[model samples]
Target: MRPLPHHRTLRPDRRPELTLSQPLETLAFTPWPGIGNDIWETVAFPNEGYSYEVWTSVTRDPEATGGLRGGVTVRQGEAIIARLTCDPDTPSQSLDVIYDLKESIGQCWDFTSRSWQTSCG
Candidate 1:
């Protein structure tokens, strides 16, 4: 685990946002299963030592991927860190999404990688 820098999540008494200390590129969502079709959800970037509180709302309509998606903004100071993108041609909501959630999002939903490894849980 990388040593996290000065960090603090501000649960504001009056605000509608969640904040993190670093850019989340590597993530593992808690229903570590399937996700992709356009659902806005959160991912944990452990390397960053913080959980990215993300979200997504359907835009226009819903398709196989639903529709255009509207979501959160991962920013640093005033610059945009990562913008939530809504891709309509994907299976965004499912029960098998395991990703890195960084600039390169990984989907382990199709049983591609060996999931279970050691004899420790």
Candidate 2:
């Protein structure tokens, strides 16, 4: 995995209204393993009343680039305000630390079926 950048930038076409230029060190990063060989990475930024979470899932296959299949979710308290899928060639950061946050919260990706499952079977 690549090192996290000092700052993260979003594609202009992805969400013109939403811009991320702050240093990533201030954000929270979480990494967790999926059902089989897949892994989920999430970076969250908290705002005044809401938070923005960027998530991506990748397989153990070294050739697979998972950035093409993730999205950004905006949430306020426990409610999801919006969800925007990422476009091709979007930029995402990978951090060195792993928090296993998703799995602890009961979220996992089923590698065989290539879908998300509440629990790994």
Candidate 3:
């Protein structure tokens, strides 16, 4: 996990717009070590006036003696706005990352809060 980037001023004064680089694609959780039992899910565009992709992936490392970790990334358009990377050694621990988006922003999962939190540039 990484420290979430600080917030940027919102353009609430500007009307929210739907300007996609491409037709929004269906988001899926694809694991890296694609083996053993794993769990994952994705949610896209959960809010009005914003397009967001949120997903999580969970897996157990056999070599780590049942250690579990999950990685998730939240993206808008093709750019990643936030990421959740589990600590390799402490697989159970996760960190959330937030990025800077120039004109748009949305919400992403915060493992610490175990809930969705606002994110912005």
Candidate 4:
């Protein structure tokens, strides 16, 4: 696997964000190579305070086999955060995700420059 770029700083123009802590909860993940598609789910902690995001992963690989690994995090609503792709030769996938929501700047920013997402990441 290649080394992906790390986003240490938050986006100024994106949107307001929540101070979600690390180690989010894992909900569910299903991957199928035999079916020619991999299913992935995780709650998204959007920049807009807090919200939910559920998405799917498509492998589009004919020789792929096994299941994808991912998780769901829940705070108030639900969302998917992390996901794993199937290995090229091997057949396995894992991920870090969540399922939930907590909206509003009060819920998001902690009403301070020092926020959960700010100091943690």
Candidate 5:
């Protein structure tokens, strides 16, 4: 995979004050190639105050029998607030279009902690 861009800046005019109660549009979506019979996808939502990412995995591998496996990560500014795993029976969002905005601030996903954090670390 290519390295994620390190340089990004938020536009002054696009700064929005948002809350969980308000309707939000998808900000980014990333899909990973299937391994064996397992497929994975991740979707991001960016808000002014807090942002969130949901990752889902679907497996048809008979060796590892399972339903859907996924979780949600919530962030406030540069700090991670929560990481929650969904039940295997739960459903995830389905998206058709994929686009990324380079004008917005960027963060890194820390696999060790399973959360998003500032890239400097």
Candidate 6:
């Protein structure tokens, strides 16, 4: 694992917002076994000693609106780091999500990557 810089600081009360520390262009999604229309993808940062796993589930609207809904969860080990959901009401073009890993924005959430800079955990 890479050593954290000594000059960095941490605030116990805050969770850090982190960006992808390394380029993730090569990551690919694999179909989740026995789960139709569900897929999972994972990436590891050996130098940083952490991995990110994302699970996605897609479902078509039952009312035959010809729309779709989906949910996604991002995790690091046993810890759930982020979550996202989309439905007919959400724009299909694109969705932007920001995870406040620097501050405790809600339950089951905390920053855990101080090496990126401030309080990542």
Better of 4 and 6 by lDDT: 6
lDDT of 6 by residue, 25-91 (tens): 3323232233444232222332253454433333433544434344444545656554555444443
Against the unseen true structure, what C-alpha lDDT does each candidate score?
Answer: 0.40, 0.61, 0.42, 0.35, 0.57, 0.36
Preferred candidate (lDDT higher): 1 or 3: 3
Highest lDDT model number: 2
lDDT tens string, model 3, 1-121? 4466554444668865443333222222122233456544444553343445544445554553544454445565656667655454444432222212211245443555444445622
State TM-scores per candidate: 0.25, 0.49, 0.29, 0.23, 0.47, 0.31
Q: Choose the strongest candidate by TM-score.
A: 2
- Residue range 1-121, candidate 5, lDDT tens digits: 2333343344688855444432223245554543456677677777768778778777667677677787767778877777777666566443322322311335444456654444635
Q: Considering TM-score, where higher is better, how would the candidates rank from best to worst?
A: 2, 5, 6, 3, 1, 4
**How much is the lDDT of residue 4 in candidate 5?**
31
Q: Cα RMSD for candidate 1? A: 13.1
**Per-residue CA lDDT of candidate 4, range 1-121, in tens?**
3343333444678875445433322222222223435544343444444444333454556676533433233333343333333333332333322212222111232324323232322
Off by over 4 Å in 1: 1-40, 46-73, 77-80, 94-121
How do these models rank on lDDT, best leading?
2, 5, 3, 1, 6, 4
lDDT of 2 by residue, 1-121 (tens): 2332233465557857656654433346655643567666777788888888888765678887644357777888878877776565454544323344445656564656644456576
Q: How would you encode candidate 1's per-residue C-alpha lDDT over 11-118 as one tens digit per residue?
A: 558675544444333344433224554444444333243334354444323434444343344545444455554344333553223343321433333334423222
After superposing candidate 4 on the true structure, give the runs of residues whose Cα lies further than 4 Å from its correct spot. 1-16, 22-36, 44-50, 54-121
Model 1: ten consecutive residues of lowest lDDT: 112-121
Give the range where candidate 2 is weakest over 10 consecutive residues by summed lDDT: 1-10
